[model samples]
Target chain A: MASVTFDHVVKRYTSDLTVVKDFNVEVADKEFMVLVGPSGCGKSTALRMLAGLESISEGQIRIGDRVINNIAAKDRDIAMVFQSYALYPHMSVYDNMAFPLQMQHMKKAEIDKRVKSASSSLGLGNFLDRKPRALSGGQRQRVALGRAIVRNPQVFLLDEPLSNLDAKLRAQTRIELQKLHRDLGTTFIYVTHDQVEAMTMGDRIAIMNAGILQQVGTPGDIYDHPANIFVAGFVGTPTMNFVAATVQDGVATASGFHVKLPKALPAAKGILGFRPEAVTDRIPDPDSAMEMKVDVVERLGSDQFLYGKVGGDSVTARVDPRIKVEPGDSIKLGLDTRTLHFFDSETELALL
Target chain B: MSVVSPATKPGSPATKPVNLERRSLLSAIRPSRAILNIVLVVSAVFWLVPTIGLAIISLRPESLFQQSGWWTALTAPSQLTLSNYQTLFAQGLVARGVLDSLITSLEITVPATLLVTIISSLTAYSLVFGRWPGRSVVFLVIVGLLVVPIQVALIPVVQEYRVFGDLSGFNPFGTIPGVVIFHVAFGLPFGIFLMYNFYSGIPKEMLEAGRIDGAGEWQLFRRVALPLGLPAAASLMIFQFIWVWNDLLVALIFLGNNKHATLTIFLFEQTRTLAANYWIISTGAMISIFIPLIVFFSFQRYFVRGVLAGAVK
Candidate 1:
C-alpha cells in the first residue's frame, strides 16, 4: 500500500475545453479518499488520470514517491474496477479473477490460490465456474472486485462501481466495500456522483464542480461546515436550503423571517444555508422560528420530510413522522441558529 | 404423510386455469405454423434439387449419365453405381487432375482465408483501439477499396506481378501463391470492414480493464479483442474461403492451365473441351461444394450471439 498524490493536475482537452483544473489531493496510505461530484464535473477524469488510463495535460501524480505520469496503465501497478464491471465475457469467474495474476506470469498454483481466496472473500465461491452473464449484477460487481483484489496492487481505483447495482445491492455492497478496504488495508481512490456513498465510505471526500475542486474534508467536517454554496447543496439529502437574504446590523433578514447572527458583521447581501435536519417542527423560541407553508409531505416511515415555502424560498425540513401534516398546511419551524451557514452572494463562499 | 390431490400441488392451481387459454391460443396459431413449416421445407428441398441431380449424375455410370437424365437412374436404381467415381479415381491423368486440383485449391483457399482473417482482425483491432494519427483515414481507405471492383485490379495486378518477377528471379504468375495473394488482397477490405464494425461494438471499458490488469497492446489484442471477434472472424473465413475456392477468373488468368490448376479452373477446362465431359464436371463441382460446406458447418458454432454478454454491464 502507498500514498497517492495529485499535484496541480490539469486535464485540458483544448484551449476551450479543460475538464479537470488544478486538481490537488494527497490520499494517505490506506486511506479511502472519494472524489464526488455531479456528472461532467471531471471527478472520473481525475481518477482516470491517476490510474494512468488518461493523460494529464499538466502537473504530476506520484504513487509512493514514484512519479507515474509517464507510465503506461499496465505498468502503473494499480487496479481499477470500472463502472461497467468490465469482466471478460468469454471467461469464467475463476479466469476473470486470475487474469491479472496470469498477466504477471505468476505460477499456476499461486494464481489459483489467490483467485480461490478472493472469490471466497467475495462470497463468490460457488460462482467460480460460471460466466459473467450467468451472474447477477451484484455478483458481477464482486467478480470485478475479486479481479482487482487478486492483483494485490498498491492502490484500488473504483470508478462509480456501485452505480450499476440496484438500491438494496448498492447499500449492501457499500458496507462490504468498506469492510474490504479495512481487511486489505490498501489505499483506495473511489469516484462517484452519489454523495451518500462518499459520506458513508470516504475517510476524506474531495468534492468537485465544473472542473474545480470545491472542498476536501471528512464527511462530518464537510457536512457541518461546507467551504462553499455548491458543497453545501450537493452533499446533503433533500439538499441544504438556501434563502437569499441581507445581513443588516448583525441580523440576517429574508422576506418573512429573521435570524440573529452569532456575532456582529458588516452588513451585506448573502445566502442563508441550513440542512433539513437543522429545521425543526418544534419551536425553541418564537423569535427564532419561521412559518412554513407546506407544499408536499414525504413520509419515509422513520423520518418525515416537509417540502414547502419558508420566507419566500423553497425549503425542506425533517419533521416527526408521527406528526399529522398535509400539503398547504402552515407550521412554525425553528431554525437551529448555531448550525446555520451564511454564504457571500457574490463569491458563493461560506461567510461563517 | 397425508395424500395430496394434484389440484392442491404447488403451481397446479394457477396452471390449471391458464391451460385452457393456452390450448385455445395454440389451436389458433397451429394451422399457420404448419403452413410455415411446410413452406420452409418445400423451399429447402427446391434449393437442394440441383445438388441432388449432381449427386445422382456422379453416381450413375458415365455411359448411362450420357444416355439418360439423372432422374431415370433414380427410378432404375440398379443402373446407379459408384463406377463413375471409380473411373474418375482410377490411376490415370484423370485421377491426377482431380487430386492435383484438390491440392491446389486447398493450397490457395487455406492460406487466403487464414491470411485474410488474421490480417483483417489485426487491422480492425488497430483501427478501433490504436491512438495514432490518420488511423480513421486508413480505415476509410480500406472501406473505399471495398467498392473497387476486383475485375478492375486484375490486369494491373498481373502487370505488377510480371514487373515483380522481372525485378526478382522468382515469378508469381502461374503459381498457387499468385492466386492466393490476389484473393487475400481483394478479400481483406470486406473482412476488415466486417471485423472493424464487430470490434467497435465491444465496449472500450473491456480493453481498459485488460490494460489495468497488466496486459500490453499485443496481449490485449490476442487475449481480449481476438476472442470477442470470433464471430466476425468465422464469417470472414467462410466468405474468403468460398470466394477463393470457387474462383475461376483469377486462377485461370494467373495460374493458366498449368500443373497448379485449381478445381474451378479444371472444371472450366473440362467444360471448354468440345466433348464437354459432364461426369467430371458434375463430380468436380460436388467436390468443390463439399469442401466449403464442411468449412461452413465446422465453424458455424462461432456465429453464436451474445459472446460479449458478460464482458460489460
Candidate 2:
C-alpha cells in the first residue's frame, strides 16, 4: 500500500539554476520504477529528495499518503543504497546490516535473527565477521543491499547501485535485483544513467532530459513508440537513425530515396527515423530503398552492422553476419515502411 | 561489483602474487637497500647515545659523576648503584619525590590530551559536516590561533584566573587543574586544525548513508568520523601530550605557591642546587623521557596509512 508520488516537484538552487523542473511521477506499490537520464540530468537528485536527504523547494513527495518533506531522513522509513556502497568501514558485515535495526531500539535477539537471515539471503552469512575492507567490490555491494533490506522499509531507493560494477557483474546483478523486487513487494525507485539497466529491469521507466521528463512508459512501449527525438535517440544500442526528409502531397522524399505516405502529415519538412535492424538487405519496396557507400563492416558473430552514407546522410544497417560485406563496397538497403517514424524537424516531435 | 579488483584486499590470493613481485623487486635492489638500512641504524645509535649516557649517570654514585664521564661507569659496573634513586625518592612516592612529580605531570597531561582529542574531533565533525553558516570563518579563526605564541597569553591568563577566583570560589591559580585548562585551551587550535582537515577528506556520502540508516549526528561521529579520524587524533594526542608534558613555563607559573611540582620543574630545580645534583637531574630526565616514549609507542598502531582506501570506490 506504499505507493510513492512526486507532485510538481521542483529543486532549484537559485533563480537561474533549477536542477529538477516541475517533475512528476507516481510509483505504484510493489512496482519497480526507474528514473533514468544522462549525467547531471537530476535523476539522482530526485531520488535523494524522496529519501529525505535533499529538501524539496516547491512541491510535496508522499509515501502512501503521508507527506515526507518535513520528516527527518531517519524517520522517513525509506532505505537508500548509495552508489559508493557506503558501508561502515569499521563495523563487521553483521554489524553493518544490523545497525539500522539497532537504531530502532530493537531487542538484541531480534536484531541477531534479522541480521542472520538477511546475511544468508544476501549470501553474506559466512562473511559476517569480516570488515568491509576485506571483501571484494561485489561482496561489498551485496553487503550494502543487505544493510538496506534488513529494515524492511515501505519503499527502497537506489542511486546508481550497479554503476560501480563491471559489465559482467552488472548484468548478473540486474537479474537478481528484479527477483528481489518481486519477493519483497516494496515500491522500488532506482535512478541510473544506463539505458540498459533501465530497459531491462524497470517495470516502467521515466526518461528525463534537461530536468524535464520526456516520457513515461514500459520498455516495449518506449522502444516501439518514442514521443520525441531525444527518447528515440537515448534508448536502444547503436541508436535509432534519424534522417532528414521532405513530405509533399502523399510522398516523403529524402536525399536518394522516397516513400509513399501511409498517413498525411501537416508539416512539409520532417525527420525520418528507423532502427538499424529495420534497414534490411532484402528489398521490400523500391521507393524506400537507397544505395549506401559502405564505410565499415563490423561482424559481431550474432549480427553484422554496415556503417555507410546513404546519399548525403551517414546510416547504419544491420545485416546477416554470413553475407559478405566490406568497407568501400556499395550495398542497397531498404527501409521497412511499417517501422518508419516521421518527426517535424522544427518541433522534433513524432508525427507518424 | 565485479571480481576484477582484488588489488586492495589483503587476504585475496590474486593480490598475493602482486605483493610477491613487489617484494622481489625490492630484493633486487639489495645493495642500495642495505646501504639505507645501515644509514638508519647508524643514525639511530647516534640518537640514543645521549639517553644511554644519562641512564648510566643516573645509576652511578654522585662522586663518580664529577670525576669522569658517565661511560666510565660502564667499565666499573660495581660503581653503578641504586643509592641516587633511593635518595631521590626519600620523600616518598606520594610527596615531593620524583614519582610525585611524575604523577603530577600525568594529572596535568592526561586530561589535557583527552579533552583536546575529544573536543577537536567534535568540533571537526561539525566544521566538516555541519550546514551552519560561518563555519569556515569559525574554522579559520581557530586555525589562526595556532600562530599566537604561548608566552603572550601567560600573563593575561594568570590575571583572568585571579579574576575568576575573585568571582567564583574555586581559583584555578596554582592548581594542577589550572595548568590543564591552559594546556587544553592552547592545544585546541592545532588539534581542531588537524582534525578538521582529516574529517574533510572523509566522503560526505558516508555520513549521508548513516543518516538514512537512522543514525543521529552523534552516532555518525561516534561510528564514522571518530574511527576515520583516529590517525589524526592519535598524532594530535601524541603532540599535545608531549608538549604539555615537557612544558616548564606553564607549570612554573601556574603551579606557583603550590609546593607540588611537575617533573619538568623538579628536574629544573635539580640543576639549581648548590652543587647541581647531576644524578637527580639525569635520573629525573630519563624518567621524564620514558613516559613520552611509552605514549608514542602505544599510539604507533593508529598511524595506519591509507585507512580510507577500501571504504569507497
The DockQ leader among the candidates is 1
Docking class of 2: medium
Tens-place lDDT digits, model 2, residues B1-313: 1123445556656556676666556666876778899999999999999989989999998887778898887778998898887887776876666888999999999999999999999999999998788999999999999999999999999999989999997889899999999999999999999999999999888899889999999988998889888999999999999999999999999995677899998988877778858888988898899999999999999999878775677
Candidate 2 per-residue lDDT, tens place, A148-231, comes to 999999999999999899989999999989999998989999999999999999999999989888899999999988998999
How much lDDT does candidate 1 score? 0.90
DockQ of each: 0.74, 0.60
Q: Candidate 2: misplaced stretches above 4 Å? A: B1-28, B93-95
True contacts kept of 1: 0.91
Model number with the top lDDT: 1
Share of reference contacts found in each model: 0.91, 0.71
Chain A TM-scores in order: 0.98, 0.98
Candidate 1 TM-score, true structure as reference: 0.95
